[model samples]
Target: MGIAGRQNGVTGGMILHRTVVLVGMMGCGKSAVGRSLAARLGVQLLDSDAEIERAANATISEIFARDGEPFFRDREAEVIARLLSGPPCILSTGGGAFLAERNRQAIHDKGVAVWLDASVDLLWERVKHKDTRPLLRTDNPRKTLEEIFATRVPVYQLADLRAETLPEYSIEETTDRVIEVLLTRPDVLEKT
Candidate 1:
């Protein structure tokens, strides 16, 4: 809590009137930044993936393997809708969540989507070593990532707000950037 920000009530604290749905590529730090942003705002961070896993009683990869991507997506949508219907909180979604039009509409109708933008190279570097990503279990993950990136970025651009995730910035810094962007949408968040 910087004195300047706290005195001005810019970054010191805020009242969230709507759920903030974090949308972007997998490695864009949605979960990490959501944690920090929720903490800064004195609210809960509900991770859609975690919620789905809890209800299904399985890891994401295991769910994908057992029930398939389509089934997982159906469950994801349900979880997202359910979370959005609750009181305002930070919602971190899976990378593919925003790609679906139904999910996008639900988010816009109930919450605000904040895209956490990152370059394809940055995203690849972050996710390449992680086998937990069921989608990246491919013969050429880098190429697959490129395709996914190209397909999804345009959709991500439709978010109500956006925050850049620079490799040089720490999670806290990125979270601050998210706060700055959210501050712009006074209807969604307000200084308190």
Candidate 2:
């Protein structure tokens, strides 16, 4: 169906009470947009990575350094599952979380998954020199980011809805666009 038709159908009240999950690369503004969207929708905003860090009682980099990526991902999935069991809320997942089939299934079953799309240049511009991202600590951060983007874009595309975010767009605009899209997907609005 066309975007307009889908929007009309969803807003017609067939479904409600489902959560919204934002999945994208690290620099794609999921956290920023999710926070705004959640505030506007009157729901809590949960960042999966942050939760994982809390659960681990350490920073993400510390977790990565101490346990490695596989271990971190396992913790991330567990945290995500726990978060999904709560009331409807806006969730912002780490860039690599949705790349795992189990994690993807968990999110798909619990909420509306929206992929925040942005170009590599835009992503680099946003993330460059950001020391917080554990994965970006390499000799060639740009090359690392590029490789990550190439590998994960397809996985991100599996989201139920795709919202393109421009480099110039403000967080409010991105959040609004996401809300507009979410208000359009009946399947997304459906309660589990």
lDDT top scorer:
1
How does each model score on TM-score? 0.88, 0.84
Which lDDT tens digits does candidate 1 get at residues 20-139? 999999899988898888878767788898999999999998898999999999999999999999878889888889999999999999999999999999999899999987678999
lDDT of each candidate versus the true structure: 0.89, 0.81
Worst 10 residues of 2 by lDDT: 6-15
The model with the greatest TM-score is 1
lDDT score of model 1? 0.89
Clash pairs detected, candidate 2? none
Q: Per-prediction count of colliding residue pairs?
A: 0, 0
Go through the candidates in order and give the C-alpha RMSD of each one to the true structure: 4.3, 6.3
